[model samples]
Target: MTTSHVPAGAHPNDGHAGPRVGLFVTCLVDLFRPTVGFATVALLERAGCRVEVPRHQTCCGQPAYNSGDRKEAAAIARQVIAAFDGYDHVVVPSGSCAGMLRVHYPSLFEDDPDWGPRAQDLAGRTHELTSFLVDVTGVQAVNDQRHDATVTYHDACSGLRELRVKAQPRQLLASVAGLTLLELPDTETCCGFGGTFCVKYPEISDRMVTEKAEMVASTGADTLLAGDLGCLMNLSGKLHRLGKAVSARHVAEVLAGMTDVPPIGAADGGDRR
Candidate 1:
């Protein structure tokens, strides 16, 4: 819904050298697919932003917070806030993680006057990767890598509903030379990988993902791309199990021309990985 690149500002300023951006590598990207984090760095640096990865970073605390453990969640939030407080802005590769920082962090510190303002400040400056690229830095294009396969995009729940990130990625993808952008039918629908939801209700999650995979296949896209790793993993895993050959990758990898890594949920013991 928002095409403005300012991250939190109504009018983004791209005139000076890029703002100092602290890159928060989400837990999934850190453990399962580190290439996405690197690709994010590639894109951010290309946008003229000076990016830094804090060494003391940990989980975004969404699991604990959602589980109703306010104490542990607040502790983790404070640590994360302290780690990146000096940066001009904080950018996250995953919308889920960015949503935690931007939407939930302030609430975590509501009773603490000292930390509440800091949390609000961090929230105001934090942005999802694609949003930051298109809105904050005004980057129109990245690397010139072209895919031979037709690619369709999936709108992850958090990025679509929480961040209102509908158009920025499609706008940037339009400029990818030789890359065919096929819009998936019902792209905004959830793929049922709601972090803990899939684990709590496997049958329901499987049914939802089955339909989502069917939608992806209906588009005849050889490659499936999305901003959130969770949704990509869910859909790609289902596609793999169904014996479908749809390849999946984070949008950042494609945009940065770093698609050499294995696609999400690649078949075990396969050369594609």
Candidate 2:
């Protein structure tokens, strides 16, 4: 239950000067779900953003910080700040990481007179992907492709609780032609994969994910969509473990119409969409 420090009156960039965006590719998306990263770029580019992936960017340090390793967390935080220093706005596909950059970074540097203000400035300019699209860029919908399957959304803890990302992705999803968004039971509850929490307390994580899997099953949706891959993976793993049939996907993948890619449990068929 960490407190979020989103700046007051902060909103997404409105394509002012054709905003230059630095994509903060989270460690999970970078290592495991590169497709989400690619789809994020496609969505942003389609909305007329000049997107750049800062090569030096690394993890947002949420894991280290949550594990009580402030020193290591701050070190990684500095690396991220330095990597995207010149960009007009930082856009992250993962709500957890984006929340770290926008809410926790400033607090991490609060005692440093030199870095604190800079960190605050950086935090102020960052935006979660869907929020940036609907709020800043005024993106109504994507025009490239559409899916006809019923989809249920899972609101990852960080995005829903810290970044207030509930309606943004839904708004975008609604715009997709032929896509049906279904309501999941207990949509706001955590899927219990709090980064290392899943690894540390496998029993609890398994129980939570089992509950989430049941909710997804109740929806009768063919696809489960979430903004954060951590929650998606947790739920997806549990779905596989339970021999359930629902497929999991990142919100960017759905919004970008990359449904041609098989669902999470499917065999390694290459990206067809």
Candidate 1's error at 40, in angstroms? 0.6
| Ten-residue region with minimum lDDT total, candidate 1 | 1-10
TM-score of 1: 0.91
> Per-residue lDDT tens digits of candidate 2, residues 1-273?
000121212222244536798999899989888889988887777676778899997689998999999999999999998898988889999899999999999999999998798899899989999998887878766664577878899998888888999999998888777889999988889998999999999999888889989989889988899999889888888887898888889989888766676766566783222
Q: How does residue 239 of candidate 2 score in lDDT?
A: 86
Q: What's the lDDT for all of these models?
A: 0.84, 0.84
Tens-digit per-residue lDDT, 1-273, candidate 1:
122222311222245455788999999999989999988887776666778899989889999998899999999999999999889889998889999999999989988999999999999999999998878877765545565668999988898889999898888787677789889888778999998989999999999999999989889888998999999889989998998878999998887777776788764556352
Task: Provide the global lDDT of candidate 2 against the true structure.
Answer: 0.84
The runs of at least 3 residues in candidate 1 whose Cα sits more than 4 Å from the true structure, single-residue gaps closed, are: 1-17, 267-273
